[model samples]
Target: MSDILKFPKDFYFGSATSATQSEGTFEGDGKGQDIWGKWFELEPEKFYNEVGPYKTTTMYKHYKEDIQLLKQTGHNSFRTSISWARLFPEGHGEVNEKAVAYYRDYFETLRENDIEPFVNLFHFDMPAALQDIGGWENRKVVDYFKEYAKTCFELFGDVVKKWFTFNEPIVHVEMGYLHQYHYPMKVDAALAVKVGYHTALASAYAIKEFKKLKTGGKIGIVLNLSPAYPRSNNEADLKAAEIAEAFQNKSFLDPAIKGEFNPLLIELIKKHDLMPDYDEKDLDVIKENTVDFLGVNYYQPVRVKARDSVPNPDAPFLPTYYFDIYDMPGKKMNPYRGWEIYEKGIYDIALNIKNDYGNIEWMITENGMGVQDEDRFKKDGMIEDDYRIDFYKGHLKWLHKGIQEGSNCVGYQVWTPIDCWSWLNAYKNRYGLIELDLETQERTIKKSGYWFKDLHDNNGFEL
Candidate 1:
């Protein structure tokens, strides 16, 4: 390998953010309440520092200036989601003209600035009205989501060429259903399966709608693919790793790419008596509507090991029943966010997609390091985020190695270009190239922002 890692000339360098996490106008402008807004209303104390969703960077108001900042940061592409509630106030039946106009202008502004807009249909922001009817657990919500997807395509398919049906669908299932972290939090393993199944069905339905329109654009799903690494080469540990991969990665990857589910995962679900009720025809739709490309979000790897003890039948069911997360000593750590930082994991994911998934076209949709109290790193009026710059270089080096070895990965997009509100954590951990002042809505380019600009301009960085 050479000391200089050069990316393909056309490889995209950009960042991503979601509407609910960045857009601040929660109630006005004819926007209906999303689950986040509703959740904040019900339990304001649950949010970080009691700072609710309404206290975002006000992208709904500052998007024009933000676009300039994107240019300043050398972004050729950007990913953001449409607020479902803002579009269809009641999830369906009525269209908000103001919301549509706002989005149209926003996307057009991005195009005018020479920034390509990659718009995602859903980003874990379900309309509160739909949640009232059981959210993703109810099959009816799937059709509603399809209708919303169709509306977005018809409305903005001109300016937006890249579309994603969902962003991290598993998070909705695992966090919202099995883990009790998101809205309508529940711990029902059976319900989690149903939600996961319906979410995939919803993506296929949306892809079906997109294909029917012939928008001349590509549609895909953004999955947070964390490669499962076993603690040892023993058969039991290998089996545990396989199960973890099937549950965490292949659960959606198979259906979205291969147009089928992993048989092992199906057997496990059956053994646990947690199979979701589904129509045979829905499986057909999923089979026929595989994605055009894939967007991978990698932040860490899942370290797995075989269970240490016999199963307890009386315990509530969870995916961890078959294996446990291995706390491998000497592992690289990002203590600020409590996530393991394994840059080589990016290379592993790319190679897995290349060898196992037929070298399908893909990109790193979200990768970044989030730090707490970033202001403490400020020196002479700028946050010297060399840590973030180093983080990006470490991952990109391995990603470049994968590309050189025949991985079909095309681009790299960071988690975000600006500091935005995170769910639950809110602004506790900052992950952005541009620093944001929550109080004044001021934006300042951090040192990483300048470093990223050079990386993007040169199409690569030195190892």
Candidate 2:
């Protein structure tokens, strides 16, 4: 490797994890049940190997040691969400003092170790009490979310200067409402639209609260942006890709950054009679309370082509009605995870933000490869994850190119620092710089972790 690639002096190097995925004290220490816990209880077999959300890496019990591990891995910044149910057990009404103290200490500890905490308000772990009353589908839930966001800011804003309203809010809409991969599984397109609309509105309300508080900190949202690629330049293919882009990327991207929904998406929703019930005043709130920055959690690109057959009118309306997934020949893929590995997608996303979204300040909040049965590659008690290191280098090279071209991108954070429980998938796949032993809760830095430290210390790596 040659020392040719370099990042900006202030570019951050860190990792991200969510509370439900890391913290194991579910329903413990006065914590209430989240959707994940509730879903697991309702259907244990839905999760891989019946590994429910009960016992994760146990960050709640071992955060101090984890912070030391974060330092050893050379993290200057870290992102994690405060569990809403943990903070407010019933979603609203009363505060859980223990959860409050836990988060305060966690943020303070990270700050004391010189790691800037990038805290997010929600990460798909909605309080079951809120979900019991219709979750994001009901407008009332939006107000409850705003209250939760405000509470988080007031409690931990001092130590955590960077705040995010939500992490991949679309995932809840697409996975839970449309695809039935998550809790409250339903396949109603209209309900998906309503849930999505309310989620964006909730984010705006949180931003409104943040601005009102005058916290002197930047507030943003984390979006998992997958650039859409047309299979061909034909009019049909182009149109399909355009619709895919609107639904997959611009739905949340436009609302969070530009403070408006994409017109193409609006037109499509109206055509399908899926317009969400919304108050005009809510639109004004969204228009005014745009994000200060963006956190992009990019992992793959969506390749699209025109649908080969006419849609069945009798079937429930869905975004897939507009296009079909294009499996491009010879495309590189992650053998372990079955997702396409397109490094240039990062460059495409950066340039898209630069040219279209006003070049807003942003960072790669989550990008990492998840491999199955990682222990097979272990050698000398340490997992030699060279593939992960190369994966980072591949994506970073493109990110560097984008930044050099005036993309205004600031940092790159891996999906996680230590292997944690993934929702539904559980620990079937591991994506982390550190190898975690679930039985012993032992944290061991992998080969990629050492490589990341050098990259972080040097602010970049050789090409």
Candidate 3:
């Protein structure tokens, strides 16, 4: 290991987490219920071990201690989201001053500790109040979101220099509308189209509002970009791969970064009569406001192939009508999460952004391996997760190459910092640098945490 992979001096190193995922006291201190809270109430069985958001890592009460752990784990920067429901209990009108004060203190604490805070506005936790009124499906809720964004900027803009409008905007579309995995689950293709469109529109409106206040902060959206690879070079396989990329990757990327919707996607929606209701005003908003930078979360690539079986014409529509997921034989697997592990996928994603998107400034916002029953690997009070360190090294090698080739990639933030309650999956899969003892609510740094500290201090590591 003589040759060290030295990153640029300015490259940021940190971990990412979300408010709903880390903050346990959801109902106290003027915090209102978000969609997750309501969903857990209605269908508790859907969640792993019946462990809902309420059983998280208690960041609200333990933020100070948590921030110390962040520093100890060698985070020069960190990403977390603000709960909209916490700020506006009803998602509109009067603001909750407690929420305001809490966030201000949170951001200031990070700044005081020499850790930059990258705050995101929405992270799949919609206000329960907003959901009762159709959520993203109704155009009215878009305006409500704009107001919420404006309020967040007015309150915390000074302390937070980096802000994101939303995280993984496509997940809501795919889960809530197309698949039945999320709340208000409805398997409707047209509604999926509508939801996806309004999400983009809402993000643009937030960007527009952020600029209006002149906060002097950089605003962007966090997207989980999974590159699509064809199983073979056949024309049908290529076509399948293209459509998968269009729907999953570019749906939000083009509008958020390029300030325009992909015409090919529009054509597909139109062909299926799934076109969403929209007007010129929203289009103008999207066109005028593109992101200042991009936050990418890449877990795995989507392997696609031509649909072998004809779909029943009578059946309802789906984005997969033109293509289907192809499972390549003998691919490496992260058995805990059942996700394929292809380190080179990160490289392909970086190169695509460099050549196609003008190499816009970006960072690896979320990338880490999730393991189940992690205690099985615990040794001498620390979880020996060498697999996680290897995972990071493999991905970082490609990321470093991307930067060397002139891609404007600035940072690498793992999926999370402290082990916390995850959505639906609960604690089934752990992706934390520090282990959280759920029973005692104690925090212990893991082996990877120490490895990360050294890597951050050295600005790189031996390959």
Q: What lDDT tens digits, residue by residue, belong to model 2 across residues 261-371?
A: 999999999998899878889999999999999999999999999999999999988898999999999999998789999999999999999999999999999999999
- Residue-wise C-alpha lDDT for candidate 1, range 1-463, written one tens digit per residue: 6577899978999999999999887456898889999999999888889888876889999999999999999999999999999999899999999999999999999999888898998998999999999999889999999999999999999889999999999899999978878998888999999999999999999999999999788999999999999999999999999999999999999999999999999999999999988879999999999999999999999999999988799987888999999999999999999999999999999999999998999999999999999989999999999999999999999999999999998899998989999999999999999999987889999999999899889998877
Q: Model 3: which ten-residue window has the lowest total lDDT? A: 23-32
Q: For model 3, how does the per-residue alpha-carbon lDDT over 390-459 read when each residue is reduced to its tens digit?
A: 9999999998888888888889999889997888899999999999999998999999999999989999
TM-score, one value per model: 0.99, 0.99, 0.99
In order, the Cα lDDT scores of the candidates are 0.93, 0.93, 0.92
CA deviation > 4 Å runs, candidate 3: none
RMSD of each: 1.2, 0.9, 0.9
